[model samples]
Target: MPRNYASLADQSVFPSISDLPGDYTCPETGGGVFGCLLVEIVSIERITRLVLRTFDRADSPVTVAFYTGDRGRSIENDPKLKPGNTMAILFPRRHLFLDGTVGVRQEHYGYFKV
Candidate 1:
């Protein structure tokens, strides 16, 4: 069963993307470096899909979505999902190609229960 989106709270924070390693590189065939940070789940919504927005201490937001399936259940049941608790997220760094095209690598970071 789908969890109620109303159960989520609205608290925001700023994620420090700049703190991520700059030396991290992506592969030519396509895979990007991983960037990790501590964030709080601010808001959640279910509109045909599940959406979660996390924030850093500074109130910066990073939003992600999960479609129906095992992945969706995982997102809903994530242990770090409390409204105020801090959870670490690992995401891929944005890649800028020499050809002047920008891309983001798709990857999902799991949470460790604290």
Candidate 2:
């Protein structure tokens, strides 16, 4: 079957990350319970490109990328992903190759921690 891509201009059809299961809790640092950092989807180009950013913890800020059709679902079926949506993501502190590259693997949606 042919894949159906969603239009980025339409915000209603965007995917929601809230229920797309995966651990998003930030790892503990210095016994202070850093918790998960809230990140926002800064950019998205349909299903081809995705960029996320965390602003508070600038010391070890989080800036991740999802590229080149790596996102498991087409844009239409993708979770409620939209620019400016604040999210919490967790890093597995590991790496895997879904497409033969040494990259952090998202169990779902290219490894989005949220």
Candidate 3:
């Protein structure tokens, strides 16, 4: 992921959480990069990686997961990742999981700003 991925991303082509395709039951690859999403974090789960449940600007429920491959174990205890704080997901893949939930799955670094 580039540092300026979000700034270079075209919003019309790659939209926000609210504009994601409803029929996408599986993961699609034209990943979007949101510079910043001032979401309301609901919970924080850290076992092997960092997972956050949040509500986006449209009040749509979402899950943001950062794999530990890039975000080391120390990120689990980061103070900035607490519930209610803002997080940014850049160049992340949009995933509609089997549970019928929409989310951003970041499998690498340089894509998250917490």
Candidate 4:
């Protein structure tokens, strides 16, 4: 039980692809209509890696589990990678993805005192 992404580092806990909104609802036709969903997440060192693709135009595959804080555990037993909106570079702080081109795929390693 040791997961500390430096306590989420000021917490802007990432996810993108415009949050992938395409009339998403169909817990198996309880309401029906679900299509076009792709996820990608890649965080290094403190480890937040995920990749998920959810589609329903006869392309079936959806199994997701991810968590890092707030009693975070049971992302399918620490699931590692797949959930993408796509963007990577977490070094010396310079990130900008102001809606649509997706974001969040960070990688930074050590030494910061400012």
Tens digit of per-residue lDDT, candidate 1, span 10-114: 222212644333325545534443445555767766554455566654565645454345445555665656577665545535334344433222244342221
Q: Following a full C-alpha superposition, what root-mean-square deviation does model 1 have from the true structure?
A: 12.0
Per-model root-mean-square deviation over C-alphas: 12.0, 13.6, 6.1, 16.7
Q: What's the lDDT for all of these models?
A: 0.47, 0.40, 0.64, 0.28
lDDT of 2 by residue, 1-114 (tens): 999885644323322222122333334632223223345555443435454433322223334445435554454345667666655444332223354322223344534444
Q: TM-score winner among the candidates?
A: 3
Instruction: Give the alpha carbon lDDT tens digit for every residue of 9-28 in model 3.
Output: 55544446765533344445
TM-score of 3: 0.64
Prediction 4 global C-alpha lDDT: 0.28
The runs of at least 3 residues in candidate 3 whose Cα sits more than 4 Å from the true structure, single-residue gaps closed, are: 1-15, 20-38, 70-72
- lDDT (tens digit, per residue) of candidate 4 on 1-114: 978663322223322233322223334754332222233333322234332233211232222222233222233244343333322222212122333322322232121110
Worst 10 residues of 4 by lDDT: 105-114
Off by over 4 Å in 4: 1-16, 22-33, 44-71, 76-79, 82-114
* Highest lDDT model number: 3
Clashes per candidate, residues 3 or more apart or on different chains: 7, 9, 0, 14
TM-score per candidate, in order?
A: 0.47, 0.35, 0.64, 0.21
Positional deviation of residue 85's Cα in model 3 after best superposition, in angstroms: 0.5
RMSD in angstroms between candidate 4 and the native structure over all alpha carbons: 16.7
Q: What is the Å distance of residue 66 in model 4 from its true position?
A: 6.3
Could you tell me the lDDT of residue 74 within candidate 2?
Answer: 51
